[model samples]
Target: MKRPDTRAASVGVIDIGSNSVRLVVYQAMERSLVTVFNEKALCGLGREVQTTGLLAADAVDKALTALKRFRALCKVQKVGEVHAIATAACRDASNGPDFIAKAEKICGASIQILTGPEEARYSALGVISGIHKPDGIVGDLGGGSLELIDVRGHQVRSGVTLPLGSLALQDLAEKSLKKAQRIASEALTDLPQLLAGENRTFYAVGGTWRALARIHIIQSGYPLGVMHGYAIPAAEALAFVRRLRRLVAADMLADIEAIAEARRPLLAYAALVLEHVIRIARPTTVVFSTFGVREGLLYSKLPDTERAKDGLLCAAQDLNELLSRSAQHARELIDWTDRLFRVVHIRETEEERRLRHAACLLSDIGWRMHPDHRGEQTYGIVLNGNFGSISHEGRIFVALSVFFRYEGLRDETAPPPLTQQLSQAAIDRARVLGTAFRVAHLISAARPGVLPATHFRTQDRKLMLIFEHQMVDLVADRVGGRFKQLARLVGRSGSIVRS
Candidate 1:
């Protein structure tokens, strides 16, 4: 029997959390998952659990309704598999089992009720999979509980969960802000894992914290609006959260109507908890992660070898295959650039090499766009793409490199203001790499086997491009000019050699 084509198959995950019920469908169950459909409803399942010890009747109803719709959506999207998970609210509420039974009937999938530690582990894994070599404490703030875990590289240490989640804390404090602050402060005073975060990064996860980050982004006039991997210094974040605690949620409505109405009330509590965490953790920076248990669930299913792959390169290669004139040519371009850089005596760190390789894969993605807009279009895609394992600064570098590949490297071809986030060294590297792309694409016309026949060499401050005997006819004045441009960026004059 012929094996079924898994390439076209889709996977869906339904997460029933304390504050919301969300369903996310991915294009496929691969290392680089691309979200095709996502929908969520604010169910607030854990809002009353602190006081009543049972899932609220209304919240359960809303969650069941959302699950029913999600099941139908999965069917509509032809999702090959569906995995459902329930978090803190469902695990602690007395009536959670009954609700889970109804939800399972609606979603047509078994519900895995995650214990506190399990939730923390998945949160850590999500960060590990999304961010490159993450060294920090992972803080997952849901409506019912806050899970704090320590993660370094691929290793995750044991973590502790506190009942300091926004909804639960609000309920426990009887809606008093002062009381909630006291509760949050007391609960976080003794966590060793949080203490271990000193001078390292603190990865923040969950919707409420994300909403807070969004507000921070708008208020601060950050050039790039993308939220994932947005970093803020610890002291600065502490000051921002303190200021948030002072503002009325209603006052923020006029400024940030983009925030969900349901999340507005909980902002203060979220801010209160975050302030306490920053104070106790003493972390140097707080980085926001959009990946959570949902991405973690998908990540956990990958084989050991697949789990070890770089998410950024995987995503880049996928895009190149789908969008480029030739994916094989893109791979060849990597080797060609490798040769060029080596011959030019250009040094690169391991991270820089991977990023340059990713840029090479993405260099030609804008070919189909109109000639006048390719630069802007491709820049936006790379800067805001859903790919992970890259920081905001790194995203700007790759985006600028691709931008310059299409638009000339002249000062007049200015990128968006967000490019300012990159350091001078990174900008120079991007320009140098972008200049190489400009020459490489012009020489090969984005086809394979051509770049392989050509080589680069240096002769005492002069860079030379050599064409094989059979391919010597491919050389011309245009190629010569671009080669000179690339060489000039590296402080060397260029000449072409026929061999």
Candidate 2:
């Protein structure tokens, strides 16, 4: 992404959520958000609908005024484009279309209303595009709804919008924030089963979750503000969630007055929802995403290579470096995996390939876990550790590669639901890449850049093994009586020495 050129050009994005209205200006040349103008005016668009099946007039006026001002900002900043979107709020409103048409007339931009699934997909893209570390599930908790996305490698596998939101919980149950916590718990019952045993990363999106993380950081004294890629250990997250639950919303009055006196009643409910989801998902760690649906939709329109500039994978590496320490050479790990990828004649989209390279960087990170159990630890980290900013699809590949690094994943079956979204081609690549990774680990022997330069070459539909002299000698020694078994792995047997 070209950041703001010497002269900045702002790109405006207006996100109309059930809770608030925001207009953001992106200095693309600088790859930075130059200005963020937003207000949490408590539109109550969903709240009024729970009673009268319509958006409250007051909420509409507040939101429209924000939009009008956003239009003025675009004019003043000379933004090239204004992309606006409404989630859960307008999408669920009976008269949302009317609002959209009216808003467009006043603001000179269409108010794109997103269905739950649409919101989930775009949020995943936005979060992923901003960071790298290819695999994970992203849950964006908006005011009126919850969007869930399953990302595998470079593609979005599946998404569903469930009728769950912080503010909406208050309105739907007619309960106090404390009582709403139970309601939030009841709502997340099926999630654990839906997410378990897959070995994917879980990420949280939306303002409420981000705020909770910020508060946790402040209260616990976690350092750093650009924590979009920070990892909160699952255990710590659980404890934090529990602490939030024990407090009476009334008791929290003094602590969070900054959230606004009006929203105090509802803010606790949002906190409860965040805690409940964290419990159900059993994510090893949770990461906060600053960008959500709007950023994602904008990212989807970017060219493929430019999209790679999204820092999810890079963010993952940063977090991993901070959270994980490796005794092995990171470069050696990457070089070995790179060689494996070449040997398998790996076929991947440019994004998937880059993400897979990330997988290589930490394949041996688990060496710190214990030599006897490095595979298990590495596998565990791959499954539960946060990779930060990776596309939902990239997350899947990361997990899959981790599975291959160990001995257990071959027998693993895909969750029945993923079949609809993960292509056959992707599954095949997963298997190929996984096997190549196994071979690379064997050659790497815990020392990077030392792997025997062996490659699989094809001639006349038969796979031939070409090996360096040193590797040929090692293979001959390791395979004494099991040469046949080794040969079967690569298709042809008597390892021939070349060069």
Global Cα RMSD, each model: 1.8, 12.6
Regions of model 1 farther than 4 Å from truth: 1-6, 249-255
Q: Which candidate is the best by TM-score?
A: 1
What is candidate 2's lDDT per residue for 1-499, written digit by digit as tens?
A: 8776565455677888888777777655222232434434556667655546677788889888877777887887788777888888687778988888888888887778887778888987766665554467788887788887776556676777766776678777776665576666776777643365144566788777776776676777643334466567777887886786566443754556435545555556766776676667766767777667867777777677766554544444543454444324444556554654565455557777776767766555554565556555565555555334554445556655655555434356343222233566665565555555555555546553445366555554344456676666546444332323333444444343454
TM-score of 1: 0.97
Q: Estimate each model's TM-score.
A: 0.97, 0.60
Q: Single out the weakest 10-residue window by summed lDDT for candidate 2.
A: 413-422
State each model's CA lDDT, in order.
Answer: 0.91, 0.63
Predict model 1's lDDT versus the native.
0.91
Q: In model 1, where is the ten-residue run with the lowest total lDDT?
A: 247-256
**C-alpha displacement of 273 in model 2, angstroms?**
1.9
Q: Which prediction has the highest lDDT against the true structure?
A: 1
